[model samples]
Target: MPARDSIDRHIAYWRAEVPGLDPDVEGVVTRMQMLVRHLQRRRTEALGELGLLSWEYDILWQLRAAGPPYQVTPTALAIALDTHPATLTHRLDRLTRAGLVERARDRADRRSVVVVLTDQGHRAWESAIGSQADAEGLLLAPLSESERRTLVRLLRKVVLASEKDGTELMVVPRSVQRPEH
Candidate 1:
């Protein structure tokens, strides 16, 4: 009914250059990759407008998700964020200066430290989350409700397959696992 998008053109080009090429496979993979990049760019722009880096917003959101008191140890945070402790420590410094977070010694363990989300930080995190959701919704607005549901289900199938394969093929390190209560 309408002209195809760039991925369609890519499939056509590949078909022309390499006979027997599987256009269906190539098209789906290419489209999925382009969609991911588009979503990432949208997220980056939304957070950047609020003066928050992606990593900063993610860390803040993680702390916020932890609920009441809104605090977690740096190690726990590092595991949740899938980042190095040193990198998170550096980010914590910037967050602290912005008054979004505060680091204090643990009362029960004098040698330990804990990170807490300040009220301002909670507000910023909420604002960022709202903006990010709006941006994502706008991106998906072109799709019908049924289309969205179908897309989500299909994507879940692919993701679950990949995750299962990954779990079978790899072993997670202890440091990356969630901390025990």
Candidate 2:
């Protein structure tokens, strides 16, 4: 038999409180939520060690991921990050002050502006991302390669179903394609 976890205890309490509760559904949802919370905490700690807040790392990461001469229009970045333009501007201001990014007039269109990633920004992004990857790897270390693959497949199915039932999933920007791993 598998070892019992906190989710198991949680489901037990809920089952007594509401007898109609489906243990299978409750268990799966609770476990996924708990896992996400755990991962978020780990990511927060990792980013903190690098002197980065989550949003700051996100902006730096998006800029670094834009291939060399790494830069992008503020509008495009706002769309990619799913943030409002005003909110993005505020973030940009903070990044700019930290010397992590700079706003430049686009040579192609004098009226347009672009956000360029500075060397310092790239280094910070790289270190933060490395820490994030290490944390994720440690989290999955208990699973075998095949198990990891299976888990991903199953999660993809769940995500697709959820998307189909409601709004479409946000499209990833073309410039932010996943690197070949």
Candidate 3:
């Protein structure tokens, strides 16, 4: 038998409390939720160490990931961050004041503006991302490389199924999609 974990105990308790509770379903759901919470906590701690709030790291990361000469329109950025334009404007104002980013008028379209990531912003993003990657690596360290690959494949399959169904949101955030080289 596989080694039992906290989810196993949780399933047992729920099965007793609710006679029809399905251990298989409950185990999978609870374990996934717990794993996400654990990762979020680790990421939050890592961001804190880099003196960044989660939203700040997210905006910086989105800009950094936008390929060289990292810049994007405020509207595009707002969409990428799944935030309102006004909210993005507020955040960008703060970022600009901190010298992490700058607002520049588009050369092609003088009326439009773009948000450019400064050297400081890139450095902050790099530090926070490195720390978060280390935390994720440590979390998955117990799995063999092949096991990790298998897990990725399985999770991708499940996620795709969810996306295909109407039950889950189908949009993949632009920041998360791999950029073409």
| Candidate whose lDDT is highest | 2
Tell how far residue 155 is off in model 2, in angstroms. 1.1
The collision pairs in model 3 are none
After aligning candidate 3 to the native by TM-score, how far in Å is the CA of 55 from where it should be?
Answer: 0.4
Candidate 3 structure quality by residue, lDDT tens digits, 73-107: 88888887899999988999998998889999988
**Residue-level lDDT tens digits of model 2 in 1-181:** 8999999999999999999999999998998899889989999999999889999988887888788889999999998888999999999999999999999998889999999999999989989989988988998999999999999999899889989967667565887777678
lDDT of 1 by residue, 149-172 (tens): 999999888878888745632333
Q: Provide the lDDT at 107 for model 2.
A: 85
166 Cα displacement, candidate 3 (Å) = 8.2
lDDT of each: 0.86, 0.91, 0.86
Model 1, CA-based lDDT: 0.86
> What local lDDT does model 3 show for residue 22?
84
